[model samples]
Target: MPHKDTQGRRDSTGGVGGPRPQEGSPRGGLTLSKPSQRRTGRGRAEEELTRLVSEARLLEGLSDSLRDMVMRAQAYLAELRTAGSTLENLAGQEGVEVLVPIGAGSLVKASIKDADKVIVSLGADVAVEVDVEKAKEIIGNRLAEAQKALQDYVARLREVERALSAYRERIRSLLEERGLAGGPEERSK
Candidate 1:
């Protein structure tokens, strides 16, 4: 005879000099181990699904930030283009009086001293005086860089969206497999 544990599972070591339980005993003792093992497997699956959903949410937030950055970059490019056009128009004018903004909706009347020279910011609070053609070139380069940055951010956002979609699909499939796909109301119970 074989020894049985408290829940009727066969002991790892049979009683000394006794016969072992048949691997497929009619008492169905082997099946008793399945419920606890299934519970463990289900718990692990739920944890993994939760983790994936959290990661997807974070990626969505990152995607939104990237989209905002792209929009800002595009707006800056438009401003640069406008500046370049204004400089071109001023290049051919002589003794042109312009209203320069001094922030806070204030403007100061100024006369162009040198129509050929324009001051271009080189970032880091640094500005340099350049001729009209050089200023236009700098603006063009800045526009190109801004466009490239916008494209890169858009691509990254698409990649994040793809990852989010994939995670959502996995979560859905796992929930359906576990018969928990009726939504949060059902899962809570």
Candidate 2:
């Protein structure tokens, strides 16, 4: 029996298990051993693991930033809610009146007399002129300022949502690369 060497060429007097068989010996009685397989790399796997860890750290930082934004948005909403409640309470308060200009050299002042009846000031000697249109303009400007603040709050909320989405995408890719992604069953759970 003859066996090939590492170079694929047959050598003399060396067979299976380091011993040569006798000439014309029973061929079926010999046993052949297979070559051992080489193990794969460790360095490349380590590098991938390191990259995954760095990505996780970045994801955590983004999540923290998103949380801060959520807190700020909550504070802004609370402020808006408080402002709305204050406006409602002020409207419901006493001593509130709607004054309007009437005909030539005349004015009308309407105030909530009790709960049901509204009282109007009569044209008498105490009649005073007030620029009601200017007053409305001032109130409208203040309301516009409040509206701008509310719009800014909403814009900040959208920014928070955008940053959170980016972090989620990065984490998903990292988990997929490591074969650690929760499959359908895990997701359902």
Candidate 3:
């Protein structure tokens, strides 16, 4: 049972008819575009903004992981470079005793039998014996491929950073529009 005027017009809104409603108020005294039964116009916008913030946080995590991966890749690259350099020096030190790693932080004192030859792994636990020169060439190939792959990962990391920046920019704009908070730069100060 809704209240009605003398002319049978429904009270303001929520009924069959009313005085056509005020220009600014279609549903009631306050004008609002209801996106769903559970949320209002601003509620919907706020929800969207929240979603954007969550996505930005996820991107931040991914960025951290990517940074970790890049650091590890660089470290591995350095190790490979050191190995290559070591091989060159090792060629001159035939019959020299060395600390051969036997896993688990343990080493076995062993003498070099053939400094001109080394074992190279080609992934999947597969390895082949080759001369020092051949091993250097193989290492060079691996280094080249790793460098290229690292570059691609770095590129993807940059893209993620850009996306995160854009998300932050959008969140900042929406917050400013609603007088909620300041942008990143403003918040820093």
Candidate 4:
């Protein structure tokens, strides 16, 4: 059974009160409840803003990484074209002596036994011998696949950037509404 005050109202702490004064406060002390509630609300808003800012930064970083990947893919495609041309030129020379690099700037003079056959890497440490035209076709197919993957990455990066921008705008509006839009230092109080 709960205790009752003189006015017949049940009191949890057995104290008669309208609004209880906090201990150690001045005479005619202020209530603790309203101020604590305000602080809780403000703290939650600040946390949300911080989270939004972090997400935006992550998205921006991802966009930059995707751009670098696209550039590297394009460079690889150019190298493949150069390699294909070199292979085509080699096909015309049958008994010509060539300097084949063994390792570390060392070269050995070698005669072309069958210049028409080219070794193509199929990934995973596996390579197969194929004709020049077939090697070109394989390189072309790989380039097309890389281009498609690059396009997909670019599209995802754009989406993340747009989402980040929207989140920033929302955070700005929230801060402005709370009268803390001046800067982070101003909002700390």
lDDT to native, each model = 0.82, 0.53, 0.82, 0.79
Give the per-residue lDDT digits (tens) of candidate 1, residues 1-93.
557765565553465333334555886544435676688688879899889888888988998898899889889989988997897798667
Displacement of residue 182 (Cα, Å) in model 2 is 20
Candidate 4 structure quality by residue, lDDT tens digits, 13-131: 55554544455567666545777767867887888988988887888788789788878878887877777677768867889998888999899999988888889999999999999
TM-score of candidate 4 against the unseen true structure: 0.62
Report, for all candidates in order, the number of backbone clashes. Answer: 0, 0, 0, 0
lDDT tens digits by residue: candidate 2, 119-161: 2222474443323343334445555665666566557656655
The lDDT, on a scale of 0 to 1, for candidate 3 is 0.82
How are the candidates ranked when ordered by TM-score, highest leading? 1, 3, 4, 2
lDDT of 1 at 189: 77
Which regions of candidate 1 are displaced past 4 Å? Answer: 1-32, 178-189
Clashes of 2: 0
TM-score of each: 0.73, 0.33, 0.70, 0.62
- The top-ranked prediction according to TM-score is 1
